[model samples]
Target chain A: MSDAKTAIDVNALLQAIPYARFLGITVDQRGNEITTVLHFSQRLIGNPVLPALHGGAIGAFLETTAVAQLAFEFAGAGNGKVVLPKPIGLTIDYLRSGKPVDTYGRAEITKQGRRVATVRAEAWQEDRSRPIAAAHGHFLLQVAEDAAAS
Target chain B: MSDVDFSPEDLMTMKDVLIEHVPHAKAIGLKVEDVKLSEAWLSVAYSEQLIGNPETGVIHGGVITSLLDNACGIAVQLTLPGRMSIATLDLRIDYMKPATPKLDLMAHTHCYKVTKNIAFVRGTAYHTDEKDPIATCVGTFMLAANRAQPLPTTSKAATEAMKILAQKKGGDA
Candidate 1:
């Protein structure tokens, strides 16, 4: 769906989501992979002693990235504007404590069906190979026309 | 870590320090409703700032995850014999439904199992009815060996206020 008529600006779509803006998540296209970044902010820290980034923030970043990925990839399939997928479930594994630093995330769409999608996301700070956390999530995909008809 | 002596009062004080020092907790306006031996309850008041979807007005799932994480950590702390730090190792959350907008959400967590270095926790988030929860989580936390520094003692007036509040709540500490 890379045709000119079907192109969609994923960043603009992300910005429309209030929580994505609240978390200060930004998206960039590196070739075909979509990278999501969460800039360091004191307001995102959960453990003051370790000064670690809140796990929830990292999880949210990954989840949002996955949703953005689905929206970007399947932009033209749905009628009208892209319908953002709703999270069905999320499982995050904290591989290490997230240091208080800028974090990056990317999601792999393992499966994309008509009504559901499964995504696996990883987040890292400083080193991409050594992710601080990884998450697997399933989201319910909605077709805009179906949504409007319902 | 060797078990150290601590009173129920000390744990309560630690909870206050935790909620105050954690920047995100403060940003989300989380409050400790109660803490017992191996359990804790936390609440976050409804605020527009926390809304994830402007169209729905429901608070973000991230906020609920943070609340459950904090509550689980607090439960682990309460189970520990002394003040010691803990970090989340893994957390799995199943969103049962969207939380009702404009209602204070509460999370109740319990540390059901503990070993030398690991604690298992389960938590539920709800608004009015506990039976009908908005989300549920199961997580594991790692207990660090180093003892945590005690929270600074409160001022006399603050202590008196805490005591009065405790009494009013029919608590014996």
Candidate 2:
């Protein structure tokens, strides 16, 4: 409910996750809608000839963002242990070619169920109308009870 | 902030960059199908190299993600011109079913829109059995403004080595 109290230091949280550290993703802002930034670098290339960005790299960024979003929400709740949500399913819509640059993405929590959490995210660069891509994800939540009981 | 400066060929070819650089993409033999200014499609032929759990002869989730990531980049390049460097802001993938070994993976992508500094795109990945997708992904990429040209990394070689090691470990196990 309150994103502020549970607000995670984006840099600290991302650094904690090795993969996030690899992508160089940083939390741009913290709240109900968690905003993050992925700095484009040489590490994310998919093709050499045309120099397009890689899809897996993008996917990793998206998946990481989803986890961070849930973490933010859990922190807001202030009563549960920080749990890592594993992505059970996801649907990606590739709208355009992602150039080699610093791309910004924003994610929103659509529904946070007891066991499953649904999230929607849109990415943009210089233009908003033309989004680089959009993603919806299903994350399996790890709750304090589930952990303690285990 | 204004407009990207790349040709259709550049846009399509950019997707190739993903295949060439990313370690997993190389392991799966990802290849481009076609590239237009505003639209692109690509595919990968199933091979022994793509297998994860060899007993089941299923493709690995890493391979599927590679295919979808390349497709999403192509979708963005289709609309933007002239080498606009983009990074994945976020990406979500759904593994509808397990991909069989030796099957062809086709990925189709389109750019939704391109604005001042942001771009939107979408795509789907399927196999010979076009009705079903081994996995589907949606991603959001943002335009990196004031970003310099990309520097080439020999990172793939290290990744390739790791894959080989993994294969050997799998075999031993």
Candidate 3:
């Protein structure tokens, strides 16, 4: 509910995705920001000795965050239907070992072009100042049908 | 190719043990089909629970990321002569196109070179032919991230076997 205009159901959009359900990711929409949560599970562990969350899981969560941001932005632009933004490329840097706890992600659109968007995302566990991983990526967005026709 | 002469059974066990050590690989049902000297091939089948967009039923990009990462790690493991811990330093992936729904994804990775402290890897994910790729990636892993923890049981045995093979190549056998 950050925008003063039309409301978008973030949770419902995530729930429709099968992988999102498997990862147990949920959205926390607040005044001016939206946060995506990744609940920890033993299945997410990649290193049993270190007991660290899988790098892939963290990367995937960050991707979801960027896509969610795009979807919300599209809905706010007066577009009725949401089209899943397709990722063009992604680079993820693992800053720290992801502990066995809940992780949160947020994405900021760095630039949006006519056909592509660039986003930077971060994921953290306990402190926002210290992120466990960071990512920057590009995604292809579909213009609205009316805009396309025009 | 390695100096070590592995029986078919050793290779099979090596592949199985490699996947078993990574819990997420098991969770996502990853299989290590081939592990050459410094190359690896792995696969994961399509499943409904892995679709990123329910409307399109396309598998999420993260699945491909995980598959490529795992393949790279296995490629690095096969390059070493002894037990050494490695952690991913960074990974970059380029998505060529959305994967065809219900088609199993396969990944092949090669660790072409390893410096004293860094290992470099490149990988590709495809459905059938490696020529037709769904995604491609390049990554680096830090070698000897830690030595305090004990190496996995099967890896220990495999390294020991490799050491003996190395000694034989040195004309000591």
Once superposed on the true structure, which residue ranges of model 2 sit more than 4 Å away at CA?
A1-4, A30-33, A76-80, B1-64, B67-92, B95-173
Best by DockQ: 3
Give me candidate 2's TM-score against the actual structure.
0.52
lDDT of 1 by residue, B1-173 (tens): 32444577776786776566666777778899988778898999998877776676878887888889888888888788766667789889889988898999999999988898999999999997889999999999988823533322355533454354345435532
Give the TM-scores of the predictions, in the order they appear. 0.86, 0.52, 0.88
Off by over 4 Å in 3: A1-5, A146-150, B1-10, B148-151, B154-173
Comparison by DockQ, 2 against 3, better one? 3
Cα deviation of B125, candidate 3, in Å: 0.3
Model 1 residue A83 CA deviation (Å) reads 1.8
Stretches > 4 Å off in candidate 1? A1-5, B1-8, B145-173
RMSD of each: 7.8, 11.5, 8.3
Q: Residues B5-116, candidate 3: write the lDDT tens digits.
A: 4556756755866576666787888899888788899999999988997877899998998899888988887887665777888999999988999999999999988889
Residue clash pairs of candidate 1:
none
- Model 1: per-residue lDDT, tens digit, A13-119? 87777777777888887656678889877678776545467877887888887887888778777654787777878899999878767899888899988888999
- How do all the candidates rank in terms of DockQ, highest first? 3, 1, 2
Question: What lDDT tens digits, residue by residue, belong to model 2 across residues B86-165?
Answer: 66655666767667666787887777777767776667778865567666666667776435444233456435533543
DockQ of each: 0.31, 0.13, 0.39
Reference-based TM-score, model 1: 0.86
